[model samples]
Target: MKKTSILNKLRSSGLRPTKQRVEIAKLLFNRDKTFHFTVESLGKHLAKKTTTKFALATIYNTVHAFKKAGHLSEVHLRGKNNTTYFDTNISNHHHFYDSETSELIDINDNEIKFDKIPKAPNGKTIKNLEVIINLKN
Candidate 1:
């Protein structure tokens, strides 16, 4: 993503285009494929690319803000460890998680099928649906 476009996106999202934020945005959107990262991992990657040492809280807050602004998606994991990962691809999809390698592979929405889906109770319908298939040896 170009600097101008990134700045526009931030502005549209009600985020100030600070130096650190601009740098972070560049690293995030200037890619050919979607990126999945945790706060710690993103901080480490940013440290290598730039001189400023971003605090964990800053990265955490920024990531959450981006998600709130609909720029990224959060993948909720339910397991013993329950580690959360952020994804740049916000479109509806599923994932295959390798427990041994701590890896998450994208599963397109068309790849899965459910023979029977339970009916929603009352007026509360299924707003969001996500499936995580855990992999094992």
Candidate 2:
């Protein structure tokens, strides 16, 4: 999407069109699929850029705001510090995490289906179900 279009999207989503937010959104939504990123990695990536320089705190704030506005989702990976990854797909699906490379791969929804949901002992309904199939080299 063009910068103007992205800015319009942010505004339509009730987010203030800050330069940092727009830059981050462009990165997150530029690709055809979702991606996993760490704050440190993102900072380092942004640091090398001249046009878009975002502070670590600003990245966190923008990410949180986008998440709150339903523009992104946070993935919780085991043995990792609450690493926040954005999902532009915004559809129900699973993920395949390559442990060695720490890559997040999307599994198509049609490729898998559950005939029946397993019962939860505590009478808790499943709000969302995600399968993170860990792969080893």
Candidate 3:
């Protein structure tokens, strides 16, 4: 993505387009397709790209900001470890998780069918539907 475009995105999201945010946005949004990453892994990936490196806390802060701006969503797996995955694809979709390899594959919304959906609580509405199908070798 171009610098101007990224800057515009940041501004539209009410975020100041700082040097660090721009670089982080490049890593997060310049790709052709959506993928998932944790702050730790993202920091490692960014460290390999350039001589300048961001602190681990910076990565977490940037990711959280992006998530708040609706550019990313969290994927919570069922486990005691409670590792978090960020998804770049904000559109409605499901995921197939390969637990052994720690891989996540996108599942098109139309591919899955739900027979019925239960009612939400008195004042709440169903915001989203997420399905994480675990896989094994």
Candidate 4:
């Protein structure tokens, strides 16, 4: 998407088109599609760019706010550090994690479908279904 269009989309989503937000949005909105990035990773990537400099806390706050605003989805990767990854694609789907390289790949929703959902015990309701397939090699 063009820069102007992206800025317009952000404004339409009720997000303030701040300098930091725009820079971060460009990184999140990739050319092909979805993107997976951690706060630290994103900060590091942004730091490399001389023009844009954002604090880690700012990144965290912006990301959380964006997620809450329904612009992004957060995924937690189970491991030693319990790292969190943000997904640009907001659609319902699964992920494939390469444990060896720690790479995250998106799995289309159509590839797998649940015909019947099991009964939820107690009063808990199923809000979202997350499937993380860990790949080992």
Check candidate 3 and list the clashing pairs: none
TM-score of 3: 0.88
TM-scores, each model vs. reference: 0.89, 0.82, 0.88, 0.85
- The all-Cα superposition gives candidate 3 an RMSD in Å to the true structure of 1.9
TM-score of 1: 0.89
Please give the ranking of all candidate structures by lDDT, highest first, separated by commas: 1, 3, 4, 2
Models, CA RMSD each: 1.7, 2.3, 1.9, 2.0
Expressed as tens digits, the lDDT of each residue in 1-137 for candidate 4 is: 78986786577667788888888877776457788888888898777763877988879988887788687888766743578888888899899998787789999988878888888779998887888888888
lDDT of 3: 0.81
* Higher-lDDT candidate of 2 and 3: 3
Please report, in order, the local distance difference test score of every candidate based on alpha carbons. Answer: 0.82, 0.73, 0.81, 0.81
The model with the greater lDDT, 3 or 4, is 3
Candidate 1 achieves a global lDDT of 0.82
Q: Model 4 — TM-score against the truth?
A: 0.85
Off by over 4 Å in 4: 12-14
